[model samples]
Target: MGGHFQGARERPNGPRQRDGECSRGAGRNRQIHRGLCSPSQFSTPRVECTPTRETPIARRCPDAPMRVAGQPQARSTVKSTVFVVVLVFSLIATGADAQRGPDTLGKIKAAKSINVAFSGDSLPFSYVGEGNKPAGYSIDLCQRVIAGIGQAVGEANLKVNWIVGTAAERVQMVATGKADMECANTTMTQTRLKDVDFSNLIFVDGGGFLVTVDAPINRFTDLNGKKIAVIKGTTTEVRLNAAMKARLVNAQVTTINDGSEGIALLTTGAVDAFAGDKIKLIGLAAQAKDPNKFAMLMEDLSYEPYAFALPRGDAAMRLEVNRALTKVYVSGDIEGIFAQWLGKLGRPSGLLAAMYLLNAIPE
Candidate 1:
């Protein structure tokens, strides 16, 4: 009588009741009262109902749906979903950061060593020297770079592990993490920059033809219908093929493994002439059995700007390499290195001297 059914009364004939009417009885009457109160009709009752401890009543209408314990409500479910999404994204970001790994200097400090890839057969630039160790003009420049790296990492006695490979293989080693950097007569081209970074210009050379002194070849036009030998996977090879195509020369190109091989092919008459960097060809011919027997053409086929190759996107390593190069250039040490490995060939040309002067960056 004191609850939401204060204005209702029991029907004398049947248990059915109209709106705002409820039966006030026990047992069967209470069941009929519960069935008659629809949730929508009693969702917002004007009269308040206070149930005592002896007669506990549900806060909602009798016909309202019941909630099982521990089930989440609609709003709570939305919040939980948002939280899960945020956590997943956080984990993904963490994984991406982990994959970035460490920088070049950190790796060097941890390993206490640096790996350098070089060409074991390319003379003057890089080659297997006395005692089967790596030596040459490029190797000397690389040693200065290594010394700078040692200073950066605070390791006065950093070990140098020289890995010998061809030009293509040396680039691959630097790109794939097998070596930290590659020191060779590697030319810096727009195409090679896609996979690796390069230091300042180290040397300047041009692609040219090397032929027997008595051979009939004198210029680019003389290469027509002749078999030319070049080292496989070199810029000279690509430039030679392009020059032949541009000149409309029908020449057969034979690829060899290294400078020595090209020299062998040309010496044996397997090819009419060998194509390579003019400076390297001169060094190779000088090492031949009869240096005077070979003649290098005066024609320049391609301009080659040499540099050291490092891992792509590694600005720190590149800076150190260039710093070392600048130091050598500015301190007059490069002249000594050039004279030691290439003095016999003659002094650095005017173009090469200008290259050194231009790349000597200030501290």
Candidate 2:
């Protein structure tokens, strides 16, 4: 097997959130188990990226440090190669940027319309609602962010042009200033931090699998060599790839555009399982024709702290966004948003409550 996971900071358990905040639930502050819908399943996969066995293996000679022609890389070199491959991917991801404009808040003020990128199918967070209009927890938070921006920028009625895009498109859109903010359930990770900035932690989540009850997989070990489906351009994909690689799972992975396709694949038996944020999987499963047809693997593939992706280097705009979020947290408005969207799934966790108290800046 490959080397163990290193340098990954698991979102702590217990009162994992900051003090003065109420916990959304008792445990890791996972998604409310909402039968949440994510537009991710609805979109056409914008990009497909994965190594046949992962190029990192090639980048780092995991075999012998010095190998003869045609000789396999020695297992002794595996540990070092694991770190090297991870580092290389990190460098490459951060180095390539869209060269986003410097002043995101200024651009918004000048344009008189702050364009916020939102997912088209991200349920309970951001998604298309009645009449095809955008709605969800994150979308509402972005509206609140706009209110904070309007207050900061001296525009009481700043126009917010909702820009709907897929997960792959939203990061570049924000980094390039095509969108002022990505108001969706996007996890902030070291690789992505290279391209765009992130707001204060809004939601903490982890990976879960949705498999047909007929062939249920309760944990990671069962997924070995299984055919799995996940949407492209998501942290879920990255985590899944890394975890599978580290565990040396010879699983066949398929990428799709949206959650719907993933569900269809699971239903149609195109793949063995559909994997995503546990909350998102719950959302997909909830909406499935047979809610009882699917089972969620309790095992977590990785920790996901969801935040808004913003333009790089625009701390002011980020602060404005955070200030809006802080207001929401301070005023205890988040519970209502959660109720409005995710309440159907379950009650908010104590950890989620703590997230607001921790992130809310008194000053």
Candidate 3:
């Protein structure tokens, strides 16, 4: 063994050559051999091949990272690669499952009756008409929409299911699908869109102040410290507070049930002014025993765009309703519906006509 190592050391670049054939003075490169045998090894030193043991040297290519033979990292890399492949396939399968089928449209088609939520007190838009049934301009517009749906579904005469609700109540009814669409005086505000979608603009109104003709108030500021009546759960209640704070009109607010209640409060001197939509203020005032006894403030507080509210994410139903409304706007039927319900308030303004024209969807 000693002699063999001595010969190997003489040719340190490689194992010793055959007898008398010395690697020394030979201008040839040498190759690394893992077959070198040894009972024990030395760093960067040659070892003799022997029958007792074998020596395996872990080698790395020049400029390449060092790796050990029989190491566990290779097995780990294979496992990780397989895991990534499986995960990609699983994600694609889940995505395929997510393609939804029919929803609200199918339910409505199966029921064969379009459920409608109308307001009991929002006159001219939707209100309790003859025999306490739902009727108004908005209701008539919704009827036209239902007629279209009836034609599409081949029902020809689809039945109507009325669900009378207030402003806040109607919003919940539509969002939960308890009502197909709310044909009420619901304003199309950004905040409301979180829960439901609105059709084209139906009625454009703004906050107006109502006061008895004999009241000391002549302007908004005159109502300071005066009791103001507003309908509870309506946009007017919120707008009334906001307007009072912004203008420094420190008036006391009283929330009532409906316009009729506000009118009653005005007659009893319980409320100094009734604040609500201009159209509604006039509607309430026109119903008084003497129409000349009350007056409405000329200035508007905020622009309120009323539209029909429907269930959120029901694109099919919303599209059908919009198509029906657009057809009405293009035809001459809208004018008659407005005259029948809102003629007492006078003709539609130019801005109102523009609403119909702009929202009249083509095709």
lDDT score for candidate 2 against the true structure:
0.77
- Candidate 3, residues 96-209, lDDT tens digits: the string is 655442265667778888888888877777789899788878889988988988877777777889998778888989888898888878888887899888887877888889
What TM-score does candidate 2 reach?
0.70
| Candidate 1 per-residue lDDT over residues 188-271, each given as its tens digit | 999899888889999999999999999999999998999999888899999999999999999999998988989998998999
State residue 161's C-alpha deviation in candidate 1, in Å: 1.2
lDDT, residue 40, candidate 1:
52
Clash pairs detected, candidate 1: none
Off by over 4 Å in 1: 1-102
Question: TM-score for all predictions?
Answer: 0.76, 0.70, 0.77
Task: Give the per-residue lDDT of model 2 (tens digit) for 1-363.
Answer: 255544432333444333322224554332211122223433543222232321122333233253322223334356567778888788777665433337777777787778888888777678888998888888888888888898787788988788888887999998777888899888898888899999999888778788988895777878897999999989899889998989888899999999889989999899999889888888778878998989888788878889999888887888888888888888888889888878886886777767777987886
Local accuracy by lDDT, each model = 0.83, 0.77, 0.77
Give me the overall lDDT of model 3.
Answer: 0.77
Q: How far is each candidate from the true structure, as Cα RMSD in Å?
A: 11.3, 32.4, 11.7
